[model samples]
Target: MAMGHYVNYYRLEMAQQREEEGEEAGVKRSAQYMALLTGPGFTGHVLALILFLMVTSSVERVRRKGFETFWYTHHLFILFFITLMFHGAFCFIRADTPPYCKSSPGSYKFVLGSLFFYILERTVREIRARLPTAISKIVLHPSKVLEVQIKKSSNQHGDGFFRAKAGQYVFLNCPDISAFEWHPFTITSAPEEDYVSVHIRIVGDWTTAFAKRLGCSFDDEQQFWIEELKNRTSNGVGGGEETISGVGVGAASGSSSAVAMDSMAFGSGASLMGGAKQRASASANSLQLQRPTEPTITLPRVLLDGPYGSPSEDAFNYEIAVLVGAGIGVTPFASVLKHIWYSVMQPTKIITLRKVYFFWVCRDRDAFEWFQDLLIALEEQNLTGFLEIRSYLTGELGKEEMDTVLMEARAAAAAAAARHFRNKHYYGGGGGDGADVGNQGFEGKGGEGDLLTKLHKPLGGSGAFPMEVMLGEEMNGSNETLSDARRDRDAITGLRSPTYYGRPNFDKIFGELALAHPQEHGQVGVFFCGPKPLGKTLHRCARKYKFKFHKENF
Candidate 1:
């Protein structure tokens, strides 16, 4: 709509210029147009058009590569609006100029109200940005993600602290980096916390310099380690047993239908690359090491502009919410997850959210190592049935291929077990303590009592969630006490939720959710912050399933 308006206005301006110049003899239209450009009204008209074109192009995908260009060009609206008003008020050219020119007609009346509102909005924003603010802490995570914690004092609110909802974003500016540059980042910290926080992925020049100012620069050795970590997943060095906690059994069952867990055992081939794997692991660890939170020197003064609303902020309004985040797009969901934890922890806070399915898709495990501890902690909490996390690693094998390979590995393991069964007496086999409970058919009822005895930390309020109840009636023969089952931890992050090897199947996931919640046709909310391709896929699925879809637009 905006583009069409701009094009139409440009065409009309050109036609009027031709018409005005055609009235004069021996004056070429091109030469006359250039001459008119130096005049007051014509100058503003041409300047406004140029500003619109530059700002429009920069705001597109071009911002990803050159954000400084986008930021500077976008702010030209101040000049563009002023020039627009000047172009209208001058009224240098007109139709039927004899009578119209006598009256000194202008477009100022048409634009005055909107221009006034625009100025008022910026004034309020400027005042809010100048409010008391200071950097509380800074941590550099893996993948060059910078976490900044800011403490703010607000005079307008009675609480005297800056307040912003989870899943919202803020525009940050540091005079030390560039006095005029401001970048937007999603707030990763919950509002209940004392300070506001934002996780910035250092992808642009502004963010890179910002990280350096905070003492997050990596030495040569550290940079070498980062390169090695990228190739670690494919060398067969990553391996871990898969376990399903009793609290998350239903969610596991639902996910297993779409994504299969990796069960491929390593051989001599993996051992040959042991040194490389260790170095990669060590590098990842070094990158994740805590930097000095408070520097000896004074920290740079930072200004914040918003507690602005985003689509993901509406997540709590729905009874069932599905959050899909890809790469750094997971930032908003981090805030939402923390908010959910706080809301559930406090009994006084009432919310409509009952279940949340969070899907985090990263290219590799190292990309999201910083988020692992949070997931592990959330898994240990009492809100077991409320939250289910699924992390996908798309760097190595794909989903379908990984499933096929796992099937082949399971068959090979079965053949080896058969050979060992015949020589039990020679091997001195007397082990039946349910230590290998998760290694085989975990959905069976054979070792319920023994597995329950082995579980040390049962999830939820009481320790009697009933393994049979979670596994359903088919596995319900034991009268033994029920507790949370042991989880299958991921080798990369040590998260209880096993990471899949590829992208998710939105159709299958949405189909399962639709089946589970028949009454929530329009009530089920699907909030996504990710790449455009995946977001479009989710949007289509939402329509097919009759669910509400909200996407985070930059």
Candidate 2:
């Protein structure tokens, strides 16, 4: 559309030059004369063209990298639209006849209504976003995923709280980070929850910087663990409990121990308050935890523009819903699943769907930490057998990685035990008196618990071990095939459903769904949020199975 408009405008300029000058003079100076016509109309066209090219080029140039570049360039639309109102003001395009062809500034008239609405929309959004919004909480998960919880304060009348349905999104603008940049993120928290939350994977510059500002540090070489080991040999003041936050974040396969950071500056006056253990305790099942210290940091002001509708918002309308997410694409499904859990847990709540199948395909096992707790919570309720979750890890976990996790677990357990023994003899600390020092090595009922259980913290008492141990060395018969299979715990996620090694077999999955829900069950709705290629594959499957398909338009 823009190209066609520009082509016509260029022809009009040529015609106008011919009328102003003689045909002979126009032919002699067509290019120079056209360039010299620096009226508002011609200048607007040029500016619009430049803005269009810059925006399009920046999107491709950044690829998966520079988010700031794309964000800044995309805002050129404001200037582009302003220029467009004057694009044909001078009326260069002359009619065939004379009297009807008088130059009149009518371009603005053509766009006046739309421009008014556009301005009005932005004005309303800006005013609403600025109204007393606060960052309630922030959680830094593995794989550089940051979860932010936002709370909206109501007016004096106790009205105007932000309301949204499941599978919706919001435009977030943090002025402390960037004054003009606003990014859209799926709302992972359900409408039933009091606060709105979003899970952001720290991939681009804006996101990486945002995570760091929220108290997470990144490292390429070290796997940072947050362990809260209560020191028995306390300070002379009172032996009060101390909480330390770990600074480094890297791949889960790293062998190095955690790096503890105290008084780490995050936001303005903000310090690290809770350890990862406390953070895990405050997952989807739990939202708040009492910290030992009152947090002094003032969280950055974040403006939110929406709880906008999305394709996945229509998920519950279907009798059978198949939700497919890839990596951070699982964010939208988080809301869907949470809403489903709420609906199922409360019998009075009405929901259209009778069955749901959620498939998450991620590259890293640690990435599962982003939404594993929510999935586990839903699983615990059984949801009346209405929901099924199948997770796939496309990335290969080599044997060496498994061995490294095992070694790290052993080292951590040994270190904790050594501390316990040292404290017991030197500080006269007693064992099993319910102190953290005493239970460091024996948190589980059985022998030395593995790091997998510690990392994920499954709801079950006897959680998963890193790997199978030798015959006599096994703590609770970890080598028994029947018992291990019965445990139904993935070594990585520690969930009842084991994570698949490679890509999911979509054909088999679709075939089973088709067989299970025949035509009588009504059309199955397949909602997906992922890359274009996987969406295409799913679209094909949907077509072959005669199901409705919906892909999120990010």
Candidate 3:
């Protein structure tokens, strides 16, 4: 571009010469200037191009090795700006005067309005990000993603003085990692959550090193489950005060643990405040231990700036939302989804949301653990009709392989459920199925403790969708073996939506959504937070069919 501009400048000068003297007269220049330009300018341009390539060569390689290389090399743009400013300040020809008039061009001349503002913006950003912040929580998800929840000090609200809308992002600066480096991360926590949170994927050197500063890694979930099972074993005969009939063993043991936990909560927080233990006791079922078996490690300090708007924040404006996310790209949508959940959980603030369709596609089953608890809590809220989550596991596996994996997972969940129910029955009296024990009668039990009557059995008969989605057939005694097999399979992976294989068909999804909500009557907002190619596909589909498309590409 600079060469083109210089070429045009010479052309204009030659045209002026041709007009001043007849066409016979030609343009003239000093041999000294010509020699210098022809020799050094040619060499300089070539060398600059070579240097550019060298800096850009194997970007992925350098990116993996260190982000500082990418950062420092990109700063070479300032040198280019400086050279161009000097080049513009000097002119080789001038027809308006006998001698070409040249001096340092006004400093303001070198400053493009946008560039000045940009530099100013960055300066402000540095100061803002320098504001001190404390890391309240650091969750190392099973998928090697780090979520940092930062608490901002405020004069009021006790939550955060820095408020950010859903789908917005912020710049995180951890001086411990690098004093100069500032990384942008999408805010994963909803505005409803007091603190700001960012999900960082450990894919590059900077991120990997940053995550290590927390000094904790995600332990194997399987080991945790094994330890839990070991702890559930009865220490005394007759299970020492069993409660319910079928799931009594698991419940009674869990109750003893719960009482011990409540006592610990009260003891630990007794001096802090009376409400500390009460608050801890209230969330006993939240799965937070009174005292974590692993000691909590002190994490390094972090700083944050901004809550810049992204495409996803607009989703709240629409009545219907269809969110598609792939792997770690799902950060932006996490905030939106959390906002929706918050709306449902706290109904004081009116929410205009009618429906939310979230489709998350990841490569491995292990990735699902990140949001599994949140998804289950939302499902338990009976928002099935409002918020539909479609998760896809894209892996090369046979039909039998997938089913076998799901069955094993379900068996583990079932065992955990039985234990939970036993604890609930032993402590107070609520059934594990979210049913109130007061409604379940003990009139026939010789009052033999309280017996939890099973309601709407998935297996005990009464024809309830057959539990097995593979075969929709009404099974009779003739296919008793098949029925048993289906029931067992269904119990292994019950009501939770099944994970599908491969990518989702956008056409099928849009077509179904279109049929469900007419375009002429209602507008559908299709939100995508993923790769550029996927967004392009969605954009094409949205344009071909009439749905408003919004995207947040990382």
How well does candidate 3 match the true structure in TM-score terms?
0.65
Candidate 3 C-alpha lDDT tens digits along 1-554: 54664565466545544322475356554333342464434444644764675468438677557777776666666666555555434443444765455554664565687578879998888777666566655555544667777776565555455889999998877776788777789988888877888878877767877766664333464235323322331111111111111111110111223111111111121111111111223332322222224332345667777978899998888888889998888888888888888888887776666888888877754455455546656777989889987666554434543344334333333444555566667866454553543323221123432222222224222332222222212111111111111122222112255455446678767877777877432568888887777889898888767889987856
Worst 10 residues of 2 by lDDT: 230-239
Better of 1 and 3 by lDDT: 1
lDDT scores in order: 0.60, 0.62, 0.56
The sequence of per-residue lDDT tens digits that candidate 1 reaches over residues 1-554 is: 43454465566556654333445744434433433553543755567576666767676578888888877777776676567656644444455645444355455777688889988987877887777776665554565676777875656655754688989998898887987787888998888888888888888889888877655565574454344333343343333311111111010111223222121111111211112222233332222222223313345678888888999999989999999999889999989998877776775668998899998888744565656546656887866689987766665433433333233334333443454453443565545543352343233244453221232332222422211111211111221221122233333334555555446778878888899899988789999998899999999999999999999974
Q: What TM-score would each prediction reach against the true structure?
A: 0.67, 0.70, 0.65
Best-performing candidate as measured by TM-score? 2
Q: What residue pairs are clashing in model 2?
A: 269-297, 270-297
Q: In lDDT terms, how accurate is model 3?
A: 0.56
Over 4 Å off, model 3: 2-66, 102-104, 110-112, 156-159, 217-298, 397-495, 519-522
After superposition, candidate 1 runs with Cα above 4 Å error: 1-41, 88-100, 103-105, 154-158, 221-295, 397-487
